[model samples]
Target chain A: MNILAQLPVIPIILPLVTAPLAMLMPSEKMGGRAPFVFATFVVWAVFAACAGLLHSVATTGPISYHLGDWAPPIGIEYRIDLANALVLTLVSGIAALVFPFSYESIRSEIDRRQISYFYAALLICMTGLLGVTITGDAFNVFVFLEISSLSTYALVAMGADKDRRALTASFNYLVMGTIGATFFVIGLGLLYQATGTLNMADLKIQLAGDKNRMVEAGFAFIVVGMGLKAAMFPMHLWMPNAYAYAPSAVSAFIAATSTKVAVYVIIRFIYTVIGADFSFAPAAFAWLIAPLAIAGMFFASGVAIFQDDVKRMLAYSSVGQIGYMLFGVSFGTEPGLAASLVHLFNHGLMKGALFMAAACVMLRVGSHNCSAYAGLARRMPFTAGAFIVSGLSLIGVPLTVGFISKWQLLAAAFDSGRAWAGFLIVASSFLAVIYVGRVIELMVLKPAPADAPEIKEAPLSMLVPMLILVAANVYFGLHTELTVDLSERAAHALMGAGR
Target chain B: MDILNFFAERYNYWIFITLMMMGLYIVISRGNLIKKLIGLNVFQTSVFIYYISIGKIAGGTAPIYVAGDMESRAHGGGHGAENGGGHSAPGADGADALPGKDALGAGALHADDMPHGDFELAGNDLATLTGNAQGAHAPALHAAPDAGAPIAGAPDSSGANDILAAPALKIEEHAIAAADAVKEVAHQAGDVVYSNPLPHVLILTAIVVGIATTAVGLALVVRIREAYGTIEEDELESADNVAEFGAARAQEAVA
Candidate 1:
């Protein structure tokens, strides 16, 4: 009974346990069907646990479980406060919904040999993400980060069977990702040596009077390292190719979770690890992160406008979305943190649905290019409807999750005494509308190719997940109390930690 | 002299600074990805050295384990040696004395006995002995009293000593106390100092991510190679553009 008190470990452990079990399943006939079902169940269980854990944390303060019963400052601990628990729920919930959709999607897109391995990699990636969100120990975060990253690479590589360019895209990602992870580790190592303790809470207590120059150097390394991972503007070179060329399932999953997790880590570092009072405050943040974020928002959107491939365009749009998140965090205020968290959740839903819709299109039309989607609304009405709704959310239309996030971020920027930041946010939304509108126009108004093959609606399995996310976009848009309140609490905790 | 003082005063800082610059240079200048990672490592390691150096106490040993094993044995050995020496010292002092010396003569012959009245006068002549004995006990008593009196008088006599020693003792004690306090603070602060572990962790993850990304990239490159028959980036771009051009031309033909 006492051992069972550690239920929080289940979210990460379930997926890890299932990943190997997936590989061990016998015969392709059984292996193919069984792993996907098993993975779906495991992901659901994780989502359920994460939701319960999030509720528990919100009601009863943070939950901290030390692995091996070894107290903190020695052994690793999994700490789920309001902020991360909420993120954990968001990520795991998305996975739960996405996995069922993946079954039908994977059947058509991926080969037989890769299906079991695909589920295994997906599970491993889930474990990494869950581990990242739950662990209180700083180094544990890194370890889990690698676990997720390695699996993500394998998943991205799976796309090569479809498009040969997936190989080049994966390779480019590998190069950039290695640099980012290396930078992250160096920063963590420096912090460890400086403080002699890897426990975050203990480190916080110890760092109060530490005004050394080395600490400042560590701060710089961490920000840059995480910035690269989160795909903040100039460091986002690897994102477009990786997202565009990967398999539809891989693209949807990575698009929804990978950069969001990176953003979580960055927020954890900036607000919790290095208290906001540190000398590298407003000036450094404004000077470094803000310009790049603004640049990314405008430039990526502009670039996205020219992409012939729908998936690639969305990939570039993702870069621009990341820019908004960075912009929110750059404000360095409670409202700003709240805005970032909101956008983090909102963007996940929007991108997940958008990518899933693209997968549906690919399933029917055999390509994700804009030309292929011409008159798609007539042939595949539901998939096209899903696309339009998700696209509207991406453009921050009212009564959608995207609008909630953008509204909060604009309000945050205004609250931070930068009223013009609101204008910039709106302008970026306008840019998004332009890119997204172009695709909508091509899908609804343009004539289908005279020689085009007859297109059928995507299978129910794929549409279920896409619709769920689109529904969530609308549901959360109108009733944002749960998401917004959770974000607010997270913001408070972050602000308190920063001080 | 300037160079000597500079080295003597800030040698640790100099070492860290040099290493930091070297690491930074490697990270920035190198073209190969792995080499850049190694450079990142060197830069981070230098920061580690800096933090560790600052936390060191001037005379303290590294926090290693040794005292637990030796403590009991050393205590037992010290007790045995002290007891043996206390008993044997009396005999050794007497054996090394001149021949014919009695216990009283031996007692008087010791180096520490001069402060008390002399006992050798009793052995010389009866008349001198009687005269010396009359005041000898008195002098012995008075000698003990004088020694006792100085104990009380010592405080007054060393008033000037107290004045001289007071500030120095205070200074030394304060310095030691401050060092100890700083050490405690540093020990606690040790956990929180931003060591930039992120960079180290990020580097490894980035390497794996890089490799994975590279594999994916190469796989894409291979696909591009198959589609266009070249691994070159420029060629792939041209081919993709050509494909787009073909698609546009096909649209034109239909129109």
Candidate 2:
């Protein structure tokens, strides 16, 4: 047996094992950095495993890893194709990069005794996301989604030492996220009742006929449930507070991966499992997602410009960016789905960098308020520089990752003959400019308070990850072939129009 | 009768929806943190009920095994005598009643009755035939209508066989054939053939997920109570707003 055939499961199993081990390892005697260092190594190992899995998938077609040697319908299967492999890589890759940065941020934000627990939760969260991406079973999706969400709630609550509001923020997220997960379970249950199978492939084959009410209801429930998790449009009430109040590392990690993973689940269900030819396809994209995405793009960006806290501002801006990704999906064309996939990957890079920058600032400034950014450019030039690069990327400035995604998305709209969508895509970037501009103005132009303490540059540990992420934003922007090609393959896989 | 059939076929689904709605209503309407989590559990359990309900077969029992013929052969002379006695039960008698009859006898109830509503065979026929518990009625069973009059209200033939096999094992062990018992088990297995096992497996995973969510949710609530001095959702919001305004004032001062 080729040992490498089992590579797809390693990413999930690594973290699953590491998380409990991290919890068992004492944090006090080894210093707060022990769990951090171990987790960083474990996450990087998961990233390497994902990279190996992706490499094998690219070469040998899809790899199906059956748990306990049972076949697909009888046992849990981990199927890795180009689409989910790319997502797996993104989640593990981002977790690996963010964990190193989390050390100092968690130290500053979380309680001394709870730091090891925080690392454990973060590792479990990563494992959950990886599992969600890799599993071939429909119910496993719900299971992994909850696993990640539950850990994420705890991770967010770890910020209670920094701000008491983190408590309420985590609670709200728990309520909303649990509801979403339950809705997802109900949807999966309905599908299981209708089709009598839990394997995603088996579900697809069983649901091939004209829309049955149970299947349609299952579809609607799943979309709405995943939308809530993705923070899609009006369902995004839980996101701002959760992102804004969480420990900066938690914010950086979750803001980058959690909702993106949710969006991936939506795409997987809509395009792959249910098939794009389902009767509800047009109405779902047109009447539901299309208009909502447009509304979100405008509504969230408008709300974002008025936010006082820079982290909350970015959180709202993240919601609007999600609108852009959904708008790409709404077109229901190959280019549209490709654009959505591209933006999904590109946006992760940009958001990770931006949130890391915010964390770097929070490290020195002791606050997330935009007012605290006064003369930050002069105070911490490197971090301020990283923030500007990522902020500009968020605004879709030329030669940045955000611009590449926006360009592809607009091109998709144009090719699909939706001139209004193209126009709106461009117009929304103007709103991005306004919100991002406000942060830049505060950092660069506002006078420093005379009573403000001398704030040193963020520790090298934090800066290295932020700078690497910022570099990725610029590097991936200039060299678009890697992300673009992978996304096209993923989109084609979704469309079922190509091998 | 039509309404009863509809309710019989669909009552599980109705209960599922009702429980689902009650759970969702509880989650949405409750303000207390613990209540909301309880509501979530109820909502999730309703789904579990829905999944488990889908796997039910009208006359089927739990997905398990009953002894087959090969195993009966291993039982030697007792197995052969049991086989001889069992197949001689009413409606099951034929020249080759020992082996093939058991296979055909269980299905003989409904399969032979092609007419939709006209067929009428009393439930007591099966009771007396399989059990021979009413030793007094053994003559009546032998004198009863031949294969002409079908067994009415047998509902499911496999279910009838299940009822046939259990008591016959003790009271009239030799009356029913060993192969018939296997046939009874096989018939029961056939009704179960269409019942899905995938949902049950998935629900096992889902239950674990539910417990995990409950644990983490309660942990978060405990932390929230520690920080805000309240587990009430409404009270927590006011505390959050107070902090929000404080930050806003701080911003205004800098500006």
Candidate 3:
């Protein structure tokens, strides 16, 4: 029971504590492997904790632990409500699965000298993500947000050995990320000025009077700041390059966690901190947020259609996926919040599977371009199978996790008296099919190039992680009670608070 | 002609109409994203100013606590009695009794007084005890101007019972009348518009948003420079065009 109570902080702090320990390892050859193994075990522990936290939150309601026993409104609190607990589980589980594969993958892609530092940075990045999800304090969220972001920049920049452009991508991400963090800070400052509180629960009580201008300003700042981080539409320019240019392992880790964490933060602010009633009824924030979501879906997907690189296309797909999550939120209802939460989990699985498969292909073919993947089904059937299954989920095929989210989102839009929004949600699924279909066709149907060398299945280390995520995509798709029920409860909490 | 004259007589409408138009124009015409942000700031600020202006009493400050003050008295004056009582009692008679009284005192009195005492006392006895009930139930009886003269001029009379009733009734009527007069004066003294916090909130949010956006824009510019060796948007476009041309030429050469 005591260990369970301490689980939320452990998920974030373990990686941070291990980062320096990873650096203290004897040498890159023998001792370097120690960090990779240790990180893998730590990530597994975090995954277990996330699962326990999720179960606890779903059954027993929100789990809030004050840091150092200082209660909220004064002390920083770590809150594992249903919404964030579910995301925490997804993120930690993916990192756990991905790190084992990173051992072999890193050996091939990154230099031997960089391996120890890479593991150190990877652990720190994990800490940032889990911390961002678990903390209840608004400013604490920013601190974790920057920690994760700075590590991500370092991880992305480490790709300079393979492609010099990775430096530029990392630099761009750094700038955009800094701006996003600054915006977040300014928003928090405004909220603090208006309400004189940093704890989300306390801020809610302080902001109920509708007489504070500073608080309202704070809400806008927080939303836009988070939107930029989540790659919301026009704000998403940094993502594709960053995702495409980074090393395959780095790309997979980030694709699975970073933006999804950002989306979680946005949802946390909209539903838990700001309350849905303000977003939906009186202010009509849905009217503002929905259009941007819809625009991102079509605009990013359309731009993705022309990309030659499969990774870049999936990167654009991430922007569109973020749009779906945003669309669910814009409904500002229980079903809407549920859809967003479920999609947050589903998209992570689909993207993790897809990017890992891309990494596998990159490992074999040494390129992520569509031309390089020609007739990969004939050569590497397992990787191709993983891609197809995850791709179907991405396209929201019936009986998949994506379908469940889209269906709920459509229902939410209709419930909100905006049936057109439902139509748009359905229409955007077709755009997904178009982009996902392009990659599948090239990988499965097209004949292999004559000059191309013979390719084999991705090694057990890589294939196992891809298969696990793909399997999760299907498992969650069929038995969605856990994900959907928790999301519904979270949405209820949000809507009830607003009213 | 009459409608136009009525509108012309109300100068507040004219100012509202003019400020609203100017606010709309600034939001529309700005070029720089930051300037547009500022325009948005002004546009939202004007709306806040308007809402505050509309809600203003003749004397009111921003609804913020002043330093060195134990309590905030910003939202005082008009509608004071109703607000002072913390919106519990719905009847106008209760509101009238506490007209123009400081909210803290009246709030405590109403919270303690009405719910316990009013239900305990019945019909005519309740009406006679609380002057508000007598004034409200029989406005015409209380309105008799001669009632005041008897209270001031006569010590003994055939209508001594009526005379005793007169002073209580007159005082209740005067308080109600005073409340109405303050309300009328507040309506006329609409120049001191109550500060609407909504626009200030919106503007502050916009400024933060603007700074964030500028940072993002500058970041994108730096990224473009690094990627294409130029910060200019047009140069980046040309660089992309050239990259596309090179790729197409390579494909043609392979064919």
Candidate 4:
């Protein structure tokens, strides 16, 4: 047995184990920097494992690691299909990039004594998202989800060191996130009651064509639950304030991974566990998911246009971006699902780069207000340039990741005979251009106030990782082989699993 | 008459739904942060109860193995599996055991071509170990408990002295032999109605997650109280609003 077969669980366990060890490191001397350095090393290693996992899952059908040598249908299995592997790589890869950037990002937002705890919480959050993505059992998803949510609450609260409002933001998120998680568990219970299995594969076998009300109720509960976590429209009240008030590093990392993983869960449940062939699937996809998705895209992008706090604006934009993904899922066709999956990866790259750029600006400017960016292009040229490029990408400009997502989504919509949705998508994207354009106007076109404080470029450690993410945004935008091929394969795995 | 019968037949579900709605009501309708966390706990606890009750085999005992089956193996969390990852026997990564093929490429995943990676690595009978849990329900289990009640609020603590069971039920680690032994003993007895151990184990994990969430939520509340001098949502909201458009926001933060 090669270690490659054993690779699926490493992404979860390595961080799960490191988080505690990181906390125990002495608070004196290099111990102050030890947590950050250690976290970076571990996250990069996880990225390697996740990349390897994707390659292996691509080659070996799917990799299922039975926890403790126990066989599945019984043991808690870590299953890695192409969809999961792609998401795992995206999450870990973003985390790996964000960790290095946090060296400077957190320096301003957190106190020295709390630095270790911050890194610890970040690692645990990483462990949780990875676990949620990799697990094959339905209930295991809940366990890992809560692990992430709890840590996320604490991570957000750590920002109280910078702004007292972060405490309230974290508390609000806690209440909402817990409710969402509980709803998920309730759904799991109903599914278990109907099928007598918590193993997802086993549940699928049992649920293939059941017209069972109990199972249907479970599906509704799961969608709403995951929808709340995914920041589905109308339920996204917590996101803006939470992202706005959070430490920059926390905002960037969570923005790039958390909601995307939740959306993946929603897709997994709709297509895989419940099966698209189920009686409820078509109406739910068309009326429920698609409409909500389109509304969120327009509604949120409109709200984002007015936000003075740039981070919060990005957060609102995140809600809007999620709409395109859901819009793709609404089609319930292979190409449509592939579009969502592709956008899923591309959005993570775009947001990770954008938020990191925001962090760089925050470090230098001490503000996230649009007015704060006046003449920022002259003062902090490289950071402003990164922001401009990523902002353009967010607006779906050509030769950027955002353009790829929009192109695929539009194609999927047209193919599925939902040409109206394709139009709506393009229309919503212009809303993106409005908000993105406003920020670009402040950063580039306007001049700095005469009394404006001098600002320096972000420290090299932060700039390197931030620039790397920006590079990935462009590289993947041009290089469709990796993202598009993997996404299509991931979509196939998800579409096939239900059958 | 039909409506009454519907409620009567699923009274356990009635309890589940009532508890769920009550908890949800409090969470949405309340203003205090601490109260909201309490509501969340109630909501989560209801789910635990719901799951436990579902795994309720009528007249079921706790999931410990019966007179023939070795019941002690369950204390190690029912599945009695290793702690995942670190304990795996090395070369477990030998991807060769899993038949290599691109999923969307040449070979479509047939049941026959399915890679039994774990079983093959352990050199166990891949079929018996399970790909067996396929096609859903196995035969009606014999009247017997399999093992473990780690969930504090578990409904099926049958014959247990306390939460999920006693110290005698504790088994830190179970070997492959333990699983075989339990199966053999279960086959012999064939008469005990045992709770499926899975939900018990799952609820146990959920309970821990619940506790951690409560702890974190309460911790945030404490910080909120310190920072804003209040924990009520209205008070916090007013404070944030004042900060949002006020120049005093910058001055106070500096102070």
Which predicted model would earn the best lDDT?
4
TM-score value, chain A, candidate 1:
0.98
lDDT by residue (tens digit), candidate 3, A1-499: 5776686688877888988887666447683688788778888887887888888888888888878765565557998887788889888988988899787777777777878788888888899899999998887887778778877877887676776566557755765665566567657756654554567886776666445455667777787888888889889988998999888888998998889999888877776677665533335455667788889988998888889989999999999889988888776677777788888888998899999999998898888888888899998999999999999999889877878888878888888898898888888888888888988898888999988887778899898888988889899899988888888887777667666
DockQ leaderboard ranking: 4, 2, 1, 3
lDDT of 2 by residue, A1-499 (tens): 7867667778888889889888877777766777888999999988999988888877777888888665665457998888888888889888988999888887777888987898899999999998899999887888788889988988888878888888778878987887888788778777765655577876677677646787888888999999999999999999999999899988899988999999999999988788888888888999999999999999999999999999999999989989999999999998999899889988899899889989988889988888888899999999989989999999888899988999899899999999999999989899999999988998899878999999899999989988998999999899998888888877887798311
Q: What interface RMSD does candidate 1 have?
A: 17.3
Clashing pairs in 2: B83-B177, B83-B178, B85-B174, B85-B175, B85-B176, B86-B175, B86-B176, B86-B177, B87-B177, B121-B152
User: What TM-score do all the candidates reach, one by one?
Assistant: 0.74, 0.83, 0.69, 0.84
Candidate 4 stretches with Cα past 4 Å from truth are: B68-190, B246-255
A253-298 per-residue lDDT for model 4 (tens digits): 9999999999999988887788888898998987898889989999
Q: Pick the candidate with the highest TM-score.
A: 4
| Residue A272 miss distance in model 4 (angstroms) | 1.9
lDDT of 4 by residue, B1-255 (tens): 999997897887789889888898889899988888898888888888877776564444554322211121122222213323322222122212334322322222111212222211222332322312221122223322212422223332232222122211222122233444334323333333344456666788889888988998888888778888998887777777677757566456545
Poorly placed runs, candidate 1 (over 4 Å): B1-255
Those runs of model 3 whose alpha carbons end farther than 4 Å from true positions after fitting are A279-284, B1-255
Q: Which pairs in model 3 have colliding backbones?
A: A213-B201, A217-B205, B52-B196, B56-B193, B56-B194
Q: Write the per-residue lDDT of candidate 3 for residues B1-255, one digit (tens) a residue.
A: 999898876555467547656654653564333343344444434433443343322233342211111111233323224233322232334444544434443222121112111111112212222323222221111111222211112212222222112211112222333433323222222211122233344345444544543454455445445555654333444454555578666455445
Instruction: Give the per-residue lDDT of model 2 (tens digit) for B126-193.
Output: 33223222121111111112343222223344543443333101112222434354334334323221
Q: Which stretches of candidate 2 lie over 4 Å from their true place?
A: A497-499, B1-9, B68-185, B188-195, B246-255
